[model samples]
Target: MQSGKFKTFYLPLAAIAAIIAGLALSFAWAAGLLGHRTTTRTFLGDSLQHFEPGYRRAHGKGICFTGVFRSSGAAASLSKARFFSQQEFPVIGRFSIGAGDPHAADTSTTTVSMALLLTADDKSQWRMKLNNAPYFPTRNAEGFLAQRSAFEPDPATGQPDPVRVAAFFKEYPEARKAVEYKATASSPSSFAGAQYNVINAFVLLAADGKRQPVRWSMRPRTTLGSLSAGDRAKASRDFLFDDIKQRLAIAPLYWDLTLQLAEAGDPIDDPSQPWPEERKQVIAGTLAVTGVHDQAAGGCRDINFDPTLVPPGIELSNDPVLAARAGIYAHSYNARLREIGLGKATEAVGHGDSH
Candidate 1:
């Protein structure tokens, strides 16, 4: 009788234990903590997480984003070179902040950003990550990468030591600007008022094979929709992920992707020089975020948005950073792909549809 009673309880307990073990295994797989998969997942997570503190440092609060895609009714009049046009393809937009690591709270006051992109014939996407503001304080991508790597914590302490940051900032001018920007920005409201810029450094090619330098801008539909001070203080680190998930759940986040085409003889290389608003030709296009891709589920993590994936009509115009990014992004993507057993990635539209 005692054996029968013990068996009854033990069987249920054993079953429960098995279920729990299975769940833990699933979580491990999802987190990419299993074997070689861990490397790829960790790299992607590190890249995204790298932005968190920078977002808080810049925005003074946290981060939030909305992504929208083009609706079918709208006409895509974006010009193209060669036989391909920018209008023919559909796009996916990923809006984020220039700062804020994956671990930091998304509600931090970093600059709001968006990447509007379209799928090319080759299955590669052509996307441009843009900020709400008009200029990037960093001198170049290499400089940006160096500062970011340094800003991360010292492995020994696992804490962000001010002394280390100070030493890094001593060499990086942009880090100095960041320090100054944060020193004075005491309140979230003060930081919210800070104008963010998406430094334009890419060239758009027209149907005539002419290259026009471009800067893109997207102003909020309503300035009243900004986060409150309380929101910042109470927000979770995943505020951006949550905010975007909620917004995309209800109404689509809408933004105008305005292109300011540069005139002839304008310098194409230097992004520091702002094109006069009057001289900037605006080609207005609507960006609608239909859905938020899951970062945890390999949506945002598995891919690299290489700007070289230009559609037919859009061409690269000797932008040094763009050229460098093309190679770097390609290598990184391939590395992650190889580690994850994902195989090689396809190239963007260029030749025939052999991709």
Candidate 2:
């Protein structure tokens, strides 16, 4: 009788203990999966493994430009930020090839990117980081790191491993948005002709205390000259960089900063998930890029357009990827500074758990 009672009680207790132990082990294993680490250094190391550390940054790896953002009453109702409500704001912009290869050919660089730092008289600033793609590839830091890992240097050849990248794509369906966008995108004749998009959603705090979720795109005012494969193929190595310089010399380049309001049921947390094409859009202001300069010795050289440098009147949405980018940008900036013997100044601080 005692044996039977002990068996009934002890068996249940043993089963419970086993279940608890299994859960604990699983949690620990899950936490450490995919070379995930909590520190900025470790995460960035993984993120940039495919590229060598250089004075240039990971994304905007080429020319830098200085400009001015001419704001009007258009954005005054949306946010109380001085830069947006004021007449003019000094802008530091960078134009670059897709990757850290500063000398990467225009045709080889699948997408071009732009980064801007808009500063107001009050010194309160807002930064916008945009890419030519209509959508983002990976939505979060983990996925971002994982995708980069897929392109990590091959042991035998020291080049990108196609098979690994293919495997990663097979596992991640969301990454298709980036691939499709890049594949169909027509090469712009000049940086001024490129349409830069802000895929992540942000909350704009109105002067009247109303909050609205919005996504924005900076559309080039210039009629873009489409480049044929033959045209890009036959062009000089630095054609994209030189083309921008020539274009800027003629007249100020213009990009209308257009904001799209997100309706209810829209995906505010996932940058990979773009809102419906029919969403309401408002033209916030014009970004007049006045000049082009070398990235190494330009105003934008030291400026880290921390995507989350959200001004007082603006708040970032719950998009995990968007939230995590500020730290990554800081890390990249520190790396650039360190590479040029400028030395690392400070550590990055931002929201979201590091993966």
Candidate 3:
């Protein structure tokens, strides 16, 4: 009788435990914890027809730079970050075009970018990935993925189908603003003349526990110049990189770090929208590009420049895109490091094979 009772109780309990384990495995698969996670590979596959192993999946064409950031003491009231103090911090930065292929021609794309990593004396680091665009094309990662899919090249024509592109803009009307901006905007004559904006907003925590929302831009001190038709015709495949290197050889390039303070009713989470021009602005500091080096030399080449990696006085805002970028960048960094370890690294354009 005791054996019969034990069998009845324990059998039911064993079946219940088995059902729970099965449900957990199912949930893990659905949540992407065990399979099919969206990553940098997903977006890159949608954007590019080919993959360049051992290199960044996006903005692969770049030049590394080292510099110094001299804080002006003007931004001390905004945040307690050491870089805001009146001192100099070492900086590693990269300048690149918005292309998936590292060997893409300089004139192939008008979009340019700057990624910066500033190291304070305390060893804390502030990293930023900025672009010349006034605002991002999509508000969130899903929207961006859809946008890339919509513009993906058709195998037969080697260009995006207008019907698909139109459908995408119809569904996501906000993206039209960025497309319009790109249509009317002129490409910078040189990288030194381009202004790079941190599209996402971040919070500055002061010593008094006060918080402020702000977006910043590196406003090049070099006067903006237009690219002449003759100059464009004569441009080499690496004109922009060559031009920056030649310019740096003569003197250091400089940009004033300008911050735009957000007021009431401003959108802190959406990077697709821009703040009003009349908002309060502050000159935080100056960034001086003291030297330029080949990517193969290993300066800023391996750095991910994840924007979410902020120092102690700074905090990430509720921007969904910012949060998504952290994961995507981490995956790209790790994947490329593995490739390098396996000796699968390839040479970047104009730079010899990475070692």
Candidate 4:
């Protein structure tokens, strides 16, 4: 009887262990650990799988940043880029925060944030991630990331400390200019009321094949636009989204997509500094949001548009961030792809199949 009982219990326990081991192996395989097949599995698993979930829970789609696609706004005239010659092209813009988790509300409370996306023709897309200040103190990504890491919340306590903020700039003196600029600024009624810009200069290719490296800015149209201290006091975490929704409901949000041309052989790598107005050209284009997209699908989905995805005629003019971002973003995107079930193996196959 004892021998029989042992056989029954041991057989079941062994079988269960075998199943668990197989699952672990499969998971690693899916995560790209074992071989090429595993790598492909990892890619699919990482890339688009979380898009739906993120959209549902976070109320955002994973596009350029944290903001959702909300709605694919109407494609109208070339009004935003007022100075450019008349030629129309279908384009899309995704507004989002520059954060790790795509679902984070784009509150002005953060140290760094942005509205990043690609142009329809892929001629002038950018990661327009900036802080509340007008200028960036660091000349490159390394310095910026270092400072951001230090200023961000402490992993242990999940609280951002004044000491960390102070130490970040103290260690990186280049940040002083930007920090000072932010400090002296008048406190706004709402952080969401502040305008965001692409601090780095980029190239905006015109219909005639001319490339103009430009800085893009989006500002509130009305004088009643200021977000006051009282307003900020009552501001919701998703103030930007709500404010945008309200604005789009009443009137289209107009943004003049201006181009700042770079001089022949001018430095384009370090985008921290701006070209003088006299030397730069302001080629304007219209960006009107007829409607806001679904917050979740627009912001938290698995879509990440990298700056390097520029089309022909619109080339990288030796921008450091552009080059750095290309590699970093490619690796990041690939990693995320691997995390999902649709791994890299299938992506290449699909790309080839399309051709």
Candidate 5:
């Protein structure tokens, strides 16, 4: 009788204990056991972790410069931001290739990029991230990761496996637009001549609290120019730097900041879907690139061109990739900081050959 009583009570308790233990294990496994962003359903941290090896924790590689941002006060009508006024502030800028690797080749690389950090007297700042390409490789962070995984180089070949890349395109057909665009746009001859775009959309607010979804770009005052294959083949590794340095000696470069208003049916949330060319465009301001500098000691070397760092009158959109960029960049930055503390890095992060 006593044995039966003990057996019934203990058996039930043991079963309950097993269930609780299993649940605890499951929770732990789900938290991080799957791996970083690639394997698990997580946020920016995980997605950014995958890029550490490929990018060397630099996020994006470029050369830094310093200049002046001249405002026509025209953008104030579009958005009442202080920088859009007639005020002139010191500008820190960067010129880069698309790859994240700091040491990537300069001469033959096709994707050109520019970053501007417009700072005010009170330390408030506006950052504009512009790329030469009109379209990005992937639409969102999910597509970005899928593209990265597919583009992983074969260890022996040291190049992307064409089969995997083809399969990736099959799976995510949206990436084809970017692939085609890049195919047509070889690297331009000089940074001063190529147009740069703020492909991501933002809501610019007038002082009256009305907001408008808008996209913006900077068109070079100089006519757009591209290099021929022969020029690229015969160029030195530091050709871009040499050219820009020589170019700056002649005159300050210029680009007009053109902001486009989104019409009805235009996709404001999806940066991958560009607005039609016929959309209403306004010349918000002018960007005068007065000078250039080396990344090692320039203002842009240490700064992140935060997408959401707008003043009071500008608001960020609900674009997922744009949202994730801030966090991902923070993660990349902290990782690099830790790596640098451990003596794995030098002070020059986005330094070019000229540095």
Candidate 6:
């Protein structure tokens, strides 16, 4: 009778322990601590191919700028953020090419980016990282990893296999849409000519507790222009940076901060899908880029420019890629900081020998 009671009790306890162990394993797998993990380090490694100790793993080529954002008070109805209160905020900005190598020729890559950190008088900050592309190429982080894997250069050919690339597009139709968009869109001749978009959606909370989903873009005041084939061939490796410096020297560059309000049917989670053109847009403010400087001159070098770093009235959306970016940026920032601390890297690096 005692033996039967022990068997019943012990069996249930064993089962319970097994269940707890299984749950732990499941959580570990989901967190990417087990199995085949796709981590931020993996992305950094893939982006650079060979690590450049002191530089960023991606967008390694860049110049800094000092600016001011003058709010129009138009977006005050949508958000209680202080920066939208018809006041001027000091801004530190960076313009970068989306190339892995710091010394990459400007003409070699069409992808460019602008990142800004705007600070209000009360010390509230709005950090934005924008891309020239209106929409992202992949819908989620997994799709991004797959896309990178597909395009990884083969050892023998020094280019990705056509079959693999074709297969990737077949599997992820959204990527093809982005490629098609780029193919048809005219290339910007100068950095000032490109419109930089914040592809991720964010929720703007007003004083009345009303929440509005929105995306924003920095629409250039400068007219869009294109470089001829001959011009591109003769362009220096730092042509884009050089052009921006020359332009700023003549006069300040300006961009209108346009906020797009999401309609009921808009997809807030999928950055690969753009909203309809009919959506309502509000000109929140104007950004004046007054000056440009090298990273060594100490303007925007230490700023991480994490998209999730917003003021109190702004909150992150459910977009997986946006969520993943925060962690990835934190990791990258911390890793680089550690490297800099250990003297394994230097903070003042990049911008075509300006260091």
lDDT score for candidate 2 against the true structure = 0.76
lDDT tens readout by residue for model 4, 297-352: 33323445555554443555566555555444444555554544453233222222
Which regions of candidate 3 fall more than 4 Å away from where they truly are? 1-36, 39-41, 48-50, 153-159, 347-355
lDDT of each: 0.50, 0.76, 0.85, 0.48, 0.73, 0.84
What TM-score goes with each of the models?
Answer: 0.58, 0.79, 0.87, 0.57, 0.79, 0.86
Q: 269, model 1: CA deviation in Å?
A: 1.1
Residue 3 lDDT (model 4): 88
Q: Which numbered prediction scores highest in lDDT against the true structure?
A: 3
| Model 4 weakest lDDT span, ten residues long | 69-78
Candidate order, lDDT descending: 3, 6, 2, 5, 1, 4
All-Cα superposition RMSD per candidate = 17.3, 9.5, 4.2, 14.2, 7.0, 4.7
Regions of model 4 farther than 4 Å from truth: 1-86, 98-133, 149-172, 184-194, 203-213, 219-224, 263-267, 277-279, 298-302, 331-355
Error of 3 at 321 (Å): 0.8
Top model by TM-score, which number? 3
Can you give the lDDT of residue 274 in candidate 6?
A: 94
Q: Provide the global lDDT of candidate 5 against the true structure.
A: 0.73
Task: Give lDDT tens digits, candidate 6, residues 1-355.
Answer: 9999999999899999999999999987655455434655576556436356656667877888999999999999889999899489899999998787767888877788999999998899999999998899888877888888898898999999999999999888889988788766654589999999999999999989999999999999999678887887888878898899899999999999999999997999999999998899999999999999886564576789999899999999999889778766765666666665677764446222462
Model 1 poorest ten-residue lDDT run = 346-355
The sequence of per-residue lDDT tens digits that candidate 2 reaches over residues 1-355 is 9999999999999999999999987775444421233534556564554244344446635667888888756877888878677888888888877766544567776678888988888888888888887877876767766776787899899997988888888887799777677768777777778888988899999889999999988999988777888887798877888788888889898999998999999989988888999999888889898888765556666777878887899999999878566666766776766754543322211111100
- Output the lDDT of residue 9, model 6: 91
Evaluation by TM-score, superior candidate among 2 and 6? 6
Q: On residues 1-355, what C-alpha lDDT tens digit does candidate 1 reach at each position?
A: 9999999989899999999999999887544355335234333345434222111112122222234334232213434532133334456544454453433345444456555556655665566655554444354545455555666887888877778677776765554655465444432222222233446456666545656566656544434444666866876765555655666678765555556667777666655456677875453555555666533231443345556666665666565555555544444555545544442322211111110
